[model samples]
Target: MSVPLTLAHLVWRMKHVHPGSEVVADGTRLRFADLADAIVRMAAGLHRRYGIRQGDRVAVLAFNTLEHLQLMYAVPLLGATLTSLNLRLDSAAMVARADRSRTDLLVVGQEALDHRSVGPAVRAAAAELAGHGITVAAAAELAADVETELPDLREDVTAFRFHTSGTTGPAKSYEVTHRDVVLHALSQSAADASGLRAGDRVLPLVPFCHVNGWGLPFVAALTGASLVLPGHDLTPARIAGMLNAERVTVAAAVPAVWFDVCRHLAELGTAPPAALREVLTGGSAVPRSVVDLVRDVLGAGVATAWGMTETLAVSTYERADPSVRAGRFVSLLEARIDGNSGSPGEQGTLQVRGPFVVGDRDGWFDTGDVASLDEEGRLAVHDRAKDLIKSGGEWIVSAQLEQHLCTHPSVSAAAVVARADPKWTERPVAVLVPRQGRLVDETELRAHVAERFPAFWVPDAFTCVERLPLTPVGKVDKRALRARHADGPVLSPDTPGGTR
Candidate 1:
């Protein structure tokens, strides 16, 4: 009953069983059978024209599009590892990642080359690779001719490698085998919290460069779901229109995208597309306010999942029960809280062991997140251990402070970072983004936190801005905030106002 679980198997099954299922992109759509044929042709082109050998590293710099999806499948079929470059990275970062991966071939999407910011990054990468004689081709040029057969591939071969967002430090490259990809797809498809099923239409607002859009493309193929890609059009209005036009049943993106979409819908005096049942969010903490807005205004349930590039997109997904606030580990993953003190609701570092999960040590992968396991076995993440601030020899959870700050009526976004202090080793500094047409007073914001949390847990300073800096994948750039404010004045509640 056991057979090799490679992407080739998934492609053949989808092509044969759901040939007519559609995949909608920017202005084009293709059936599963056609998509499979295109992937084959592209694989052949990469092998013959581009000199892509088995086990070679192929890097793709592009926005989410139909062609990008084809490359996602094609590179794996060629027995090569696909490295998706984050389009949001600057030119230097892109060049650094391409070089670090030792990429043998680079494929650039025409749309990305036309982009003002991404174009320069792609050109810089191309220029650097030229010296190495690595082939750089437009994605469109690789999709012709469909007369090639799938190469014999082993399930254990590394098929995908994605770099971290580089927010905390230098981005690290994580590798996943073909079997890892296949099992992750199956696990996601089987999770009821995923809200994915046959005949359903799914749109991934997340970029393909980020964990292959959290593995939606493969999940869609395996479950016979219609895949809808947004391409380079990430505007809230455009995304709302697509949700309505495509009748998307399941969608996934970061919390920021959902917040913008909800705001756009409200501005138009509209509700979520009636077809939308679940909106899956991850990549960062989901604010409770956003969750309430999705339920009350958008008429959809918000499902929060947790994972990273190392865990293969998803390690845990929220349970279906309304009372379960945290996610439960997927069936294939085993999770434990390291350094637990054997107390009720004790928090510790989360460690996971799974077939597809990667780590430097044995089978165990440290997630670098502080979490607590509830009586029901649901895992609630507290914060990143690095993001935790030590003040007066006490640990302060920045996520908790940010959550409280976001509850303020005028605060739309909040980030907390550690500032070196002469007295305490470090002190917490709060950065907040104000809601449109509203201004947040530092004194009042500090009071809001002081009332809710212990007096010592209150932030030492508060900075209000029009917006918070975000990383490539839309998570708050706490590192950038710390760098910007580390040398600035440390305000107190008595201070008139904080830095802008």
Candidate 2:
């Protein structure tokens, strides 16, 4: 029973046991058997036509499509590492990432090639890559008619390389071995954090290019679940339609996507289908209102997870108890609060280590997040270390402020950033996005915060935006916001208070 832990093994298991399972994408449905065959053909085609070999880096620049899913297994089958390029990155950033990853071949999605908004940039990057001897081909052009046997791959061989979101700074690439992927998938499937099960229809609204769609594709293949790909139609309405049409049991996405879906459901006077049981929300903080909405409208429990690109998508899953705000770490993962001298209730930098985790120097990897363990050993992430605002030598967690602001009935979303201050050095500024057709009163918001927090914790100024800018991965783009308002006017106690 000592089988090698490779993605190829997972695919072979699915092909033999769950071959009849369906993977629906873009109104087309294909069985797991067909998918297995296609992957073999694609692997053979890539090797014979493109000369792809073991240890070569294959970069895939695409959206969430069937083709992208195929490459997720096919590239690894050839014993080559797959680097999924972020489609949302600008041309320069995209090219820089490709160069940094040392990609040998670039596979562009046909849809991305034909896209009016992003196609030109992809082509420009492709041309630059071509000049550097990096062969560029459309994913559709890489298929072959002949099947190829899977190459022998070691468990320790690097299977995939993912680039960080680069929200705070330059994006860093992290490699995950075949063993890492297999263990992560098995742990997630067994944990059943999102209530995934065999034959359950699963749809990942997050792109496969992002943390392997939070590892849902692999988890689906492992658990015999039907994988539902949304293709390029990620609109809230479209996603809702697919959820109903496919009777999806489990779904995952960032908080922003769920917000839009809730709005769409409200507009349509509809609720999620009866089959939908769980909605996993992450990528950013999940507002309490969102959790309440999903439970009330969709009748699905919302599970909030916390992880980074380096952690392989998720590390903690909220416990079943509603009173527990923190989540428990998955099996085989160990966590601690760095530099914490107090009891478990004290907050500090969160560090984790496990077989699948990266950046472990001395058996501990700093997560760059401030967290605390409750009496029940559940983790509560307060805020990112870089996002904390220091005023007069005191740290103010921005996530706490954002969460309180989102509780306001009229606010749809909120982001807090540190604004440079002449006296305080850094002051908290609140950015509010109002609910549709609702006007936000700065005086009312100030009063709301003034009641919950001390005078110092209240934001010095408030800015209302139609929509907060988000990073490519859908988290609030606080760095961009800080850069935009860093040199702007700062409000003080002596200044008159009004909405900007």
Candidate 3:
């Protein structure tokens, strides 16, 4: 039960916990031994078929299904680094990462690309990718290989690469080691059984990106917890059905996924499937309204964990206490704020370090989020700290600008992107999706934001829209937002790079 330092030890632990029992359950199931055998054989195939030597990069682009998890364990079993593509990234970003990591081969799943409308740029890039070949494989193809001695991932070697999500420039690839995976799994393990435990059946909506999904899948394999994998699509109705059908005990995902699921549950004339026990949400903001509704209606445990692909696990939260039903405000992270190094309490950059933390320290990982620690000792992420605008030499948090704008009675949702501005370096621009049929004009929105936030913090222009673009992981796609409104006449930046 001391965290499986080596993946082989993790497998041994899995066999010890549930050996012949189902570790991954789709409509049917595969036992720990079944999974173990499959992973071993696949590792052999990777070596024999593609020359995937230990430490080579093998990329997988697919939804969260049993096969993805198989690849998750198998890649490392072969001592290769698994590079998970942000399925939402258009082909160009995807190709760039493939190039950066120098992926040896790409395995694409049918379900994953079924709905993708990747651009021509990505197509060209994928075609010219230097990898041996791009393989379009399926669950059926993987079931055949089941006999071989697979090499264990070198704990000291790079085990995977996490991409930057590329909301700004092209994505950057960062390596994660086998040691990182083991320690991360350890960190998620409850020091006193307060977090995860044996016999806990978990329903995970996060994709098998070797990031958010890292710890949960192993819960089933390493601790005899049942894993219900929801293949890619996270429709509210589908989520409700899975929660009810599987009687999932533990659930995790970004807030937006749950936001829709919660709405679906309301539509079905029921609260979150009564069988559900605890829910963990992150990857985006949890509005006070959403938190209030979950507490009042569902009555199930809901906790928020903050993490990044870079760190591999939860670094900090405004709230993570067991005693308090603090929806998402508990501070699991311990750190200090030193002036402009970060915001004071309620507004500063969040810098964190811990056993599970992943970062290229020169030492700290600048999360680019502007956050504040409330009097209750909870951390609230206001917005990306990088998204801040310096107007007249003072900081203007776009999140504050957006929050104020959204508060206007006629507004439904609002976002503030950095606009080009030569004088202030940058300024805020409001993009609003008005409440259905109700008209909230740009002038009204500007006046509304100005009255609430400081004048310097006010947005210089407005771009009305029906919805905000989202990154593959489901957070607001600010990169696209910047591109959409970057060239507005209201503010002109000195350089073209800042324009978008």
Q: Which is the leading candidate under lDDT? A: 2
Give the per-residue Cα lDDT of candidate 3 at 204.
79
lDDT of 1 by residue, 340-446 (tens): 87554789998888887766427778889899888767888889999998989889998888887888887877888988989998988888767766766777887
Local lDDT at 323 for model 3: 19
- Backbone N/Cα/C clashes per model: 0, 0, 15
Q: Could you tell me how far off, in angstroms, the CA of residue 323 lies in candidate 3 after the best superposition? A: 18
- The TM-score ranking, best first, is 2, 1, 3
Candidate with maximal TM-score: 2
Candidate 1 residue runs with Cα over 4 Å from true position:
319-324, 341-344, 489-500
Ranking by lDDT: 2, 1, 3
Which ranges in model 2 have alpha carbons more than 4 Å from their true place? 319-326, 489-500
Clashing pairs in 1: none
In order, candidate lDDTs are 0.82, 0.83, 0.64
lDDT for each residue of candidate 2 in 210-257, tens digit (9 for 90 to 100): 889999999888888999988766788888888888998889898888
Error of 2 at 451 (Å): 2.0
Tell me model 3's lDDT, rounded to 2 decimals: 0.64
